[model samples]
Target: MTMAGTLYLIPNTLGPADAGAADPLRALIPDEVQAITAGLDCFIAENAKTTRAFLKLVALQHPLAKPLQEIQINELNVNTPEAMLPQLLQPLLEGRNAGLISEAGVPAVADPGANLVRLAHAQGIQVRPLVGPSSLLLAVMASGLNGQSFAFNGYLPVDAAQRGKQIKMLEERSRKEKQTQIFIETPYRNAALLETLANTCQPGTLICIATDLSLASESIVTRTAAVWKKQLAAGKAPDLHKRPTVFLFLGQ
Candidate 1:
């Protein structure tokens, strides 16, 4: 019987590469993650290009024993066929450790990597999640909202009316159940989403906007709808345009 290799869940940095910066991997991503990542030559990633870029950064810290070209990266994305998922674990079945990486943050959380992870478990492969940054957890932690219970809604409806209705429903649920409602939007549409939130939610509803987390330009602010509206009126609100952000809401 062949021993199955462990499947490591590796976390990638949220921002672009900065070779000159101090601790470019950020504070939360520990040395252990880098060490573990260095050992794995096969990776299943959301995007092969970005994953290779991340590997290069890791190589900066720990030189790769094998040539960079030798490293195998299998791409996984939303449109990837479910039938092809098992192929991603072939390395593990062959007694070679494999890494699951996302474009940013932890894999399998908001990423399609979850499908592969689920298959790994069903195949009895060892699934190990390394310590790393998660935008969802970070936002909830800093939001000062109900961390005890929170829901990640991914992305709300794109239509204006539908989006407003969805926002109102989420707000109502948050208030009634005392749960934190978390969601995200395309970076470009962030400002519009904030506008919808301000219009749809009650004045006392608490909204947390966490953007560029773990980066030099990181910003995390929690304020009521009324307060945020006041800031908007004064042109003091942080611009979320083209910035990766996590939005959390809790009704007061």
Candidate 2:
């Protein structure tokens, strides 16, 4: 019987394709991780095009085991059907090592690759996760909040009133549990979310907005809601529009 191949959870660069770096991977990805990524010829990715782009950068440091055109890539995203997971896993079951990649950061955290990772474990396949940048963890580390006990709340409501209620609810939970609440927003709505966070949360709540994590333009700021409100009032709010960010808060 053939040995089941291991499932490698590979991490993509945290920045965008054109993040103004000569080589984004060189700065963020460890040499060992890049070498492992270079050896894989089969991958399951959130976006095949973006995965190929990431692979191209990996090739800059270590030549790929197979040429880009010859490598096999399968797509797995939010819309991928549950029934399609087995088909995607077949090559691995048949002894072909495969990599799982997210559009950015590590796969299976906020990415849709979670289900596939679960299925891989159910199949008893060996799973190995490589070292990489995770924006959620980075934010928690920089927030000066409760990193020992923190929770990632993903994306919040988009509606203003509803979003406000949700922010209050999260703040309350943080206050009671002494936990840090971490979340994200659509790039275009980042400023709006910051505005709402400042307006809705209590005066003493600590709000940390970590933007462009691991990139040259990265910024991580932790301030109380009152201070944020003051900034908003004075029109001194940082420009967050159309930038990738992670928002976290811990209430007193």
Candidate 3:
């Protein structure tokens, strides 16, 4: 199964299937990777330790190689290669292949792997994205928001005053221009944020909260500010605050 040394970038989920399960490139696993990387030198990853932790969950006890723990995923050392020059190819140059993996979702899409991809491309190192889930796309799909015209604004300002002003402005803009503004906050603070949004935004504003997406306990609900107030006041807060969430400001 060893292929000398070739840099391979496998996405955790580019679309929606578990790549390690049914994909043709099953060697994406640590054991499989161990098999193929007998002579290889290192791996280029976001978090070498954490990535190994994930592979450990798959019960992949890589054997017959130097040791899975010793291989390096040189992402932690640098912020970004400054010049896109040949010198930065140190990780892949050590071997034929450097398996590129992001912390979550597809590499290079909304992650730091783009530089690696660009470097690989410049060197003709094959770059392929594997299949997995994406919270951003998943949110858009189930959001009832205009996916085509929407934008993922990542996280909003964390400062309470700034966050409130921005939400109100977004609510107004979404209403006036028919734009869907989607944003997220840490799960623990969901209730507080919800309170702010409910109280700050005008009544009848269409707001959607998508939480625990694709998991056992999932909730996707669209409600007006007024209606959400009533629902939450009635103790129907839902289980969103306990998990991750995506909030959408869809102007009416």
Best by lDDT: 2
Mind giving the per-residue lDDT tens digits that candidate 3 earns over 1-252?
Answer: 322335565544222224354332243333344344344445566666655644443333334234556655566334656564344465456455556666655456556767766866776656655455566777878877777677667677889999988888888888877888888787788888887877777778878888876654667888888888887788877665557788887777
Once superposed on the true structure, which residue ranges of model 3 sit more than 4 Å away at CA? 1-9, 13-42, 57-67, 77-89, 93-95, 114-126
Ranking by lDDT: 2, 1, 3
- Deviation in angstroms for 238 in model 3? 2.5
Better of 1 and 2 by lDDT: 2
lDDT of 2 by residue, 134-242 (tens): 9898888888999899998888987877888889899999999999999999999998888898988899999999999987799999999999999999999998888
lDDT of 1 by residue, 24-57 (tens): 6656568888989988889999999999888887
lDDT pick, better of 1 and 3: 1
Give candidate 1's TM-score.
0.96
What is the lDDT of every predicted structure here? 0.90, 0.91, 0.63
TM-score of every model versus the real structure = 0.96, 0.96, 0.70
Candidate 1: Cα lDDT at 89: 89
